[model samples]
Target: MYECAVLSVYVDLALGLAVTFLLLSLLVSGLNEAFVRLLSIRSKFLWAYLRDTLDGADDRTGAWLPAGVLDVFRVLPFLRDPRPRHSDRPAPAQPSAVPDPGERAGDSMINLLYERVREIDHGKRGRTSISDIPPARFAVAVMELVTAGGDVDDFLTRLRQIDSPLYGPLKGVWESAQRDLDRFTKGVETWFDGEMQRLSTLYKRYVTWVVAVLGVVVTLLFSMDGLEYAKTLLRDNAYRASVTAVAEAGPEAYAELRARCAGQEPVACVTETLSQPALVGMLDQALVSLSIPDQGAPSVHWNGGRWWDRVTTPAHWPGFLLTYVALLFGAPFWWDVLRRITGIKAKR
Candidate 1:
């Protein structure tokens, strides 16, 4: 009975992930197209508008006003992180907070002018240059992305072996980023906004939601054995074998019917139940059994969800893995913030 309850939880989590994955898979192709459209207008317009509004000193350089405007904020260093013995992690500094947006132009102009002098003297040394042509940075970013092969292990392994002069500077920048990120997390612990005089439950929704997610994580961690049980049961049960068989067989019978789903109607039908990958995979397996190998170009990598089976499933079991990974990420950030704000000295 105890094991049954645990199995139920495993079932629910798998179901939840399956539901999320299915919906994502169904909408993914359309979402990709929508994203392309969104970027076409918003990305460029936002940049140009921000640039023009922030800097108007005859347009010799890009926006200076924005930098100056940022300086107007009554921001203070809520946390003092340990300065790295040798890293260019900018010492976190505070600026005055902006109470209103109306005085931005006049206030920002002077601030920008002041910042211009400081930057001219203290800009990052290894900054990449840009010309009218598309910057090589994007190419480099793509190379990094592609060479990593979408795996963390491969990315880190290759990073250590990189012998290029270009890589040495990037390595330093990466280390500094790690330091800054550590400080940011540390600052968050005691960080308070002028807007919130007291940290009410309502004011701490971000922290609260994170805690709730942690509860979900704890539940999953305790259910790991149950998850393995579910997989094993699914593999061995002859009653479940019928379900898998139906999914694997008789593709032509369902394929024509599914094809008639003009829009996302077929996938959308199970939008509440199936995650994209499970539904898509189930459908595809049935189709192939009916001797219909799909010639359709695969969906976006993020959406298709097949990559999970190919990549993650091979390395580890399925069901809500990245969710835990994300929480792991947030843990460090929150811990750092707390440490900085509370001035918790780390044990050596």
Candidate 2:
């Protein structure tokens, strides 16, 4: 027969770990995003491909069209800036938040190419530039950018100059569409769609690696001796009970927090909640209940020796494994598990 009290304690311990992993996931995600932006990997790849595709002839002057295609959000006004707006005036330093620039921009390289092509074909249509070009008309815009009253041979010559390794796979696609100018633009768009999908896969893998690295760093910073923490959770009845209460209360609190951040779709809610003081306080409270240190403490008790001990101790393996590896699954998985477990507990 299983002891009901022991089961309840274990359940709570699991929930507490879930909460910890969720918070770590958020932190990891934010750091990874910053890292990606700092390197400008996505934008660089996008711009490089656009430049190579449009100015493949190495014609710096003719590359104007591809060089001017702006970012999607900047081009489309109705889409709106999903992030919160802040004033230009300096404010008190707070949690790390990405800088948000409100609406104001010029043509992206693609849009620039569109504008130049449109100018050559029909002259100024109005005050509007290629940034205002609709998605459906993108292929049309590309066709104009490439042809612009020129022969198919000239168009192919410009495209041939794009020898970048990233464009290697699309070479065949481009070659097939070259003979037919009308189909060329459509083919290019199709190729771009495929490349975007590839990029999406690549980025997800990068984010996963970043999350794992950050997880380890976070655990170390907290002096989170997984083995000792596990022992406390299992042996100290009062501590386990307190952590269990917090775990039971967490989901409802999280739901309320999500409601408060109600804005655009998924991303807006996540960003807003992450920046909120209430959410931070709740996480801090939960961490305290679980006897986890968040910020660095003055005492040097939890140093290299404790870390070494945790790694060597056979008994601590379960808790250590959970703490280190849980983050690889990401926060959503753990949250889902917590919800299912709580639901079962409630039913009983």
Candidate 3:
């Protein structure tokens, strides 16, 4: 009986910690998504990738293009500054002379292809930057550019004369197509898909770092100490039991919430999940019960005060770091663990 009671205490402690981590994960995820969207990180990265691919540069410096080549693309309305300008502010002065057409001639093919792709993807909708382009659409744009008012042979000859890094690979793709337009379009789509997969992997790595930084920031902001919280739950049986009971009822609601959020962007999905009244209320209640200083309290100043003291204390670092690491595994991970623990508890 003593062993069973001990096991029950440990299980309840686990449930409480899982719930705490889950709430923190949700907070961090929402903030990260919002930050990424507000800055248009994905769109910026895609724009850069497209530029590098077209210019045949290994990096963003675009050294392959002649001076003033990019200026032509920059002037396009869709490529202009995305930030809203103030009506009261004066317009910037225009350049004294038009960019020499000869200087931009080498980039014309890429420029035309980009414009065609933009028309197909965005249509009448204004877009400052394209966040995504379907492979099929990209293939269509390339084919239209190559075949418009000319034969493939003439286009390939002109492509060879251009000073772009894309010449070699594009030539290979064209040769492999064996003069069949359908085959060439399919090959272009395959090439686009491959490049996008690489970009996606790179973006995922970038997001991982973003999430890690956000985790640490959120942990510090909340004064969340994993070690301290665990000790509190272990010693305070009533508090642990109450938190665990609340968490036990969470999985069903969480599953429903996830179902409803399916296929939405991260920002939208997280916003919906965090805005749920019942979830917010439960999290608030649990956080209020914790020993950490409340954000709304006057003593919680960050620069200097009891809060700083709490932060600077050597013993608190371990807990803070622990919570930060836990958050890196993400909300979905903690949610799965919560569901499993709840199931086990029910069986007992």
Candidate 4:
């Protein structure tokens, strides 16, 4: 019977992850097509122009995949040019150090880079290298609109007021353009240097965050799922309480959760179960609270403000997590980790 419960849990999770991964694969396949069509799109604004880079048409996705999962497809060896060489002449005197800075003095290397990529190949596959897609191109597209008719003042004025994440990065670049077109060209080199450093730092931060998140996700996938099944079993109580309640209880349950978040109930006095986020948060809080043994996997419980800790031993959390991880994803996880750690590529 114990084994049967575990098996049933595995079946549910396999079905779920399989469906999710399949959908992800299909979505990526669609993106492969969309990226090609987008190159023709042009706009005075950089944001609109940035949209043109994608080969796919449909990007409306409600499901958010983690950066790590997305990175696999993003950093695929065959997709991008490893040795990214700029198409434009080298920047005069100093080079634009950004990933693909152009040779132009006052002009955005990003713009020239775009010109070169299109020059290299527009519609044909195996024509232009994929690494040509850099953030500078997006920045330059916006700059083109600003620099039209050589009006720098209006552009800077409007740019400062606009709300955007890129605004900060592009500020120094534009300021360089305004101050010295020749000296500003020198400034462009500086700007590229800064941007490259910024991006590199951001990428490192992203890597650390992604790894920690994967650890947490892997932990939950193995350990808390069984506990989730147990909670589902407990919800059978609400189902038994009243047939009518069962129909209405979902909204009611949410309302009860909101009330708890508002601190209407004392910590120990609450009777209703927490929402998923709150439950996950509680498990994290518990790891710190109880001084529980730390393991590669994290554990969670849905406490209805009662002492459920006695039922689920602190020690069992790691075991359950490991068992689930090993049973469900051990092989694939090990393979991926080995490949990533060793920088080894799998042959196609």
Candidate lDDT scores, in order, read 0.33, 0.47, 0.62, 0.39
lDDT of 2 at 314: 71
Q: What is the C-alpha RMSD of each candidate to the true structure, in Å?
A: 22.0, 17.4, 14.1, 21.0
- Which 10-residue span in candidate 1 carries the lowest summed lDDT? 75-84
Q: Give the TM-score of candidate 1.
A: 0.20
Better model by TM-score, 1 or 2? 2
Ranking, lDDT, top scorer first? 3, 2, 4, 1
**Which candidate ranks first by lDDT, i.e. highest?**
3
Q: Write the per-residue lDDT of candidate 4 for residues 1-348, one digit (tens) a residue.
A: 868856755554444333333332333334433532343111111212222221111135211111253542343222322222334433233222222112213223334334533433333333333323344543454445445424445544433443222345456655756665545445545665565555455344543444444544444332333444344444433333333443477655655544644765533323333323223332442223332233555434543333235225675575445434443433345456445544679999
Better-scoring candidate (TM-score), 1 or 4: 4
Off by over 4 Å in 3: 56-110, 119-127, 238-304, 344-348
Candidate with the larger TM-score of 2 and 3: 3
Candidate 2 TM-score, true structure as reference: 0.50
Candidate 4 Cα outliers beyond 4 Å, as residue runs: 1-135, 157-214, 223-348
Mind giving the per-residue lDDT tens digits that candidate 1 earns over 1-348?
868856755554455344433333323324433543433322222222223322332234433222332221111111111111122333223322221334444324223222222222221222211111122322233233423244323333333443212234334434544635333223222231211223233223423443444534442432222234345444333323333454677765356435544444554543422333333333232112122224754443232344234223433334345434333333345455445544688899
lDDT of each residue in 69-115, candidate 3, tens digit only: 23423322234332211122222222111113355443454455555
Give the top-scoring candidate (TM-score).
3
